[model samples]
Target: MTGFCNMVIISLFNWIYILSFFVVYTADAGVQNHHVDKQNNSKRLLMDENYYTIMSRLDNLTKEVEALKKENALLRHSPIAFLAELTKTVSGQNHQIHFDQVKVNIGNAYYPSHGNFIASVNGLYQFSITACSTANHYVVLELTVNTSVVGKVLAGDTGYDECSSKTFLIQLSSGDDVFVQHKSQGDYLLSASAYGFPSFSGVLLRAL
Candidate 1:
């Protein structure tokens, strides 16, 4: 820009010199020279505008990069993960239903022995379950978060084979427990398969 301004100053001095020397020149020639100068001035103005536009765009790109970096940092510390199952059967009454098979246990939140998931961070979570039972046997499954029943599903209601599945989302605090439990008494079994057909799953949807 400094160079451009210097050139403009030189051009202005030269134009003054031309005007003084061309005073005795034909009127038509003088008019043509002035028109040419106007065109060059317009072109320079356009170039200056383009330079500012480019600088503005560059600054916007820098800001976007910074925002992406912050988002990535948040994800690194985000308490978000999922746990699912494929095979294992649960049965009985008023007990935590265990999924013998685990497909995804993000952060190792789910424990097979205790049949529950302990949240590692405070966040919103999504839970789902599909419990299957044999003929004439209906199993009531309750989705619980720290002894509070948030959702429920029932299987074995369908004649030959029964499958009950549901998905819901909830907010949880760190160290909170999440699990599916058998609601009713009697001989009822939940079917889990190696193919992961009937299962329970939960995921940390977002960090609080």
Candidate 2:
């Protein structure tokens, strides 16, 4: 009886040792798995953050490129803007004249008339002229565009003897002549009063 009880106790101790060893090994394996899962989660989060950062930077770069493209398109389409820029560059570089009864004689003897202003260069030109008659006189004015006349204005008749003014616009090419000639003769002067006589002024801008 004593021997059997001792044997039973030894058998129980061996079984307890085996079970404890299995429990310790399982716990260690679980801890390692938990650590690996945590590392994987951290890596995923880092990757997500990096992706978001890159996306934001790409979006900003795209917007910047779009803005630059719009600006370039506007500059390309707006001729006035380009002309303003060009005028700024050449401002104060050339001689400008406000014509009021100013005689422009090309050489010495080619005194064509007192009314015609000739251009030397061939390009698009914008012309503006204003003329007035005073006192007992009639005004007959013609605005010539290239070789064809574009506008004509007449003032003063038998009964209506007062001050009259006319304005006109013309486009010219190179070697084009723009001028005014008096059709009637009387004791009337071109350009009277403090408002000044008939005048012409404008710049040659490129055509559309």
Candidate 3:
């Protein structure tokens, strides 16, 4: 009976040891599985963050490109330049007149000459003129465009009353010419001025 009892106790001990070993192995496997799952989740989160960053960068680049395109278009369509031409005529000793600072040179002394002042763009032109005489002088001023007379002014009073200025709103073409003429037969001291060419700065962009 004693021998039988000892044999039973040893059998029970061996069974408990085997069960404990299996439980430990199972716990270790579970732990390894949890660690692998955590690692996978971490990798996925990093990938999502990187993808968002890349998309944001691409969006910003696209906006910049669009803005550049608009700027380029505006520059291409804007007007290029504006121009101004001026001339003056002074009375000689007798009834003779001399032309100075003629912006456009058309013909020689004999034939009826034509001169031009062109604006590079089509816009409202502010035409102006100022004239004065030392003595009682009679002067006829005629404004012309493309050789066609548009308006006229006469100055022949005793004092500064005859000194006058005129401004006109003129629509100009790319290569149009504006000119002034002395209509009266007698020679008179005269001076003329103009502004608005080569981009509204009173400078000529081209010679015509």
Candidate 4:
């Protein structure tokens, strides 16, 4: 009876040791799982932050591209340019020289009948004029902007035909008038095909 009781006590101790080992192993495994879950959460948060940053940058780039496209389209559609030539001899002082022969009037800003360039928009403009005079006759031409003289040129020689030219850059408002007129001096002009015809030309440099 004593031997049986001792064997029974030893068996119970072995079972207790095995149960304690299993409980320790299970607790360690739970700790490991919790650590892994924390690492995965950190990784997920970092990935989400990077994605949002990249998306914001891409959206700003798209907006900039759209603005550039609109500016390019506006520049392409609105163009102002014109060129005309004096077709016949002009006489008289203070006369408005009519460059009636149209060469390239892209914007229709130049009027051959009235000999004037009317501004369509407020802008900085460049204008040029070429004048030729008959032999022994001197001509002084003036470029006028709304009755204001902005430029002048004189063309004449002692026994030969002469030519002179002038260019001007001015700011203009919409509906402003620009034209070439003879100043006080000799007024006869030559119109020979051998020489280039007297010409008036203008272009819009920039919109105000």
Best by TM-score: 4
Clashing residue pairs for model 3: 82-197, 82-198, 82-199, 83-196, 83-197, 83-198, 84-197
lDDT of 3 by residue, 1-208 (tens): 9999999999999999999999999999999999999999999999999999999999999999999987676445433322223244456333212223334332221111233355554545555444444356766556666767776555556664345556555666666666666655435644443322111112322221
Q: Give the TM-score comparing model 1 with the true structure, all chains together.
A: 0.58
What's the C-alpha lDDT at position 126 in model 4? 95
> Residue-wise lDDT of candidate 2 within 59-103, one digit each (tens)?
999999999987675444422110000011111211222232333
TM-score winner between 1 and 3, please give it.
1
Error of 3 at 45 (Å): 0.7
Off by over 4 Å in 4: 1-77
**What number of clashing residue pairs does each candidate have, in the order they appear?**
0, 2, 7, 0
Which RMSD does model 4 reach against the true structure? Answer: 5.7
Superposed Cα deviation of residue 72, candidate 2 (Å): 1.6
In candidate 4, position 57 carries an lDDT of 96
Error of 2 at 105 (Å): 26
Error of 2 at 133 (Å): 9.5
Misplaced by over 4 Å in model 2 are 81-208
Candidate ranking (lDDT, best to worst):
4, 1, 3, 2
